[model samples]
Target: MTRGVGSMQDTFEKVIKHDELFHEEVLPRLKKLEEVQEEFRVEIGKITASQTSLELTVMKDGQQTRDLLGRFVDHYFGTDDKKLVLKEKVTLKQLSLRAKIALGFIGVLGGSGGILAGVAAVIEILKN
Candidate 1:
């Protein structure tokens, strides 16, 4: 019985640690990617509406050039990959949460008595 309890504790710790990591690393990256996508969409719309067909130029250190969309595409897509990465991270987070909830429910249901008894046992454990 102690061994089973130990295993459960270990698994719970692992899940909580992973949740923290995901919240720190993945969520921020997703937010940045979303911002970049919105900016890119706005720029594309402006570029498309410009009637002159003037070559888009970027000026840096007194140097001006064309190929604005190409450069922007590279930077934008590079950042947007974070969106895909975030989707995978979110799926993992959701799966972990679901598993934790299911484990708690199972612990209640399968522990020899019904819901009230399971709650009592949990309360008793907490009191200790």
Candidate 2:
């Protein structure tokens, strides 16, 4: 009867140790997994909302019936009308320096005009 009591006590101690190991190790890991899953759920919800907004914009732009991807294909194949003219690809070295110079000139002129307008406005304010 004493040997039986010792065996029962040993079995109970082993069970308690196993329970303690699981509670200390496995429970924390399970909680971490739950937190990661919740973050993933939130990210997926944001992605879904963004997709819905894009779809709404496409529909509003009257491009719903025309497959959005098909437009790209049509443009690539040069099937789109003049309104959807495909852009010409230009290699960097192949570009006309004259065009670059013209663009630069226009930008400088526009910037100077804006500065003059601001100065004129300030002068008018000072005079007033």
Candidate 3:
């Protein structure tokens, strides 16, 4: 019974030492770490809010520019007499043939060699 009592006392002293070390050493560092984490979180929130505000401003400006350009086009170019007039009347059969030719041309241009050639042709045309 005395040996058991001595063991209990030893264990109690060890636990007291550990509790003192935890309170003196670990607790303050843990509190500091928590404070730093809170600061980082606040900074991230500020950066995200700034980015969202900038994106909203850019979207509003783009919408305003698009509305202004659309109004200008309606004022200047919205007339029946300003419409394009084809030289020949296109029949349904001719339209179908033209569509087929266009599809074939697009298919050819989809190939790598054809894409290079088409780019070269466009560059030449632009140069001219």
Candidate 4:
């Protein structure tokens, strides 16, 4: 009975030493692994934020490109709300030479028009 009791006490002592070894050796390693995992989680969060910002920048650049293309088309083809000539680009500009020519023609014909009207009136009076 004393031998059996000594064997049981030896087993209990071994269990306590194993528990102490586990606490001294394994627990610090587990704590360091937990810290490394937390660091990895923080790095992953930073990468996610960077990826989201890059996506937004890409989207903004795409929208700006579309807007520039629209403006280019509008500048070349004119807007939707106005008349346009296809064969020739027309910008309305008045020439003083054309105005001078029109004035000369008016001055040359104005006296003849009044004289012809007066002659018609005279002929009607003679007829009466």
> Per-residue CA lDDT of candidate 2, range 1-106, in tens?
4656559878989899999999999999999999999999999999999999998997877765567767777786666454344333344235465554444455
Candidate 3 residue-wise lDDT, 1-128, digit = tens: 46565598789898999999999999999999999999999999999999999999999999999999998888776553344233223342354544545544665568857665455545444554
Per residue, candidate 4 scores C-alpha lDDT tens digits across 58-102 of 999999999999999987667533455422233322324444445
Rank the models by TM-score, top first.
4, 3, 2, 1
Find the candidate with the highest TM-score and give its number: 4
Q: Could you report the Cα RMSD, in angstroms, for every candidate shown? A: 44.4, 20.5, 15.7, 15.5
Candidate 4 ranges with C-alpha deviation above 4 Å = 4-6, 79-128
User: Quick one: best lDDT, which candidate?
Assistant: 3
Give the per-residue lDDT digits (tens) of candidate 1, residues 1-128: 46565598889898999999999999999999999999999999888877334433323422423366667887899789988899977874565444545545676778655575456555544655
Instruction: Report the C-alpha displacement of residue 92, candidate 1, in angstroms.
Output: 99
lDDT of 1 at 102: 58
What is candidate 2's TM-score against the reference?
0.44
Instruction: Give the TM-score (vs. native) of candidate 3.
Output: 0.51
- The 0-to-1 C-alpha lDDT of every candidate, in the order given, reads 0.70, 0.70, 0.73, 0.72
Q: Give per-candidate clash totals.
A: 0, 0, 0, 0
Task: Give lDDT for model 3.
Answer: 0.73
Q: Sort every candidate by lDDT, greatest first.
A: 3, 4, 1, 2
Better of 2 and 3 by TM-score: 3
Give the least accurate 10-residue stretch of model 4, judged by summed lDDT. 86-95
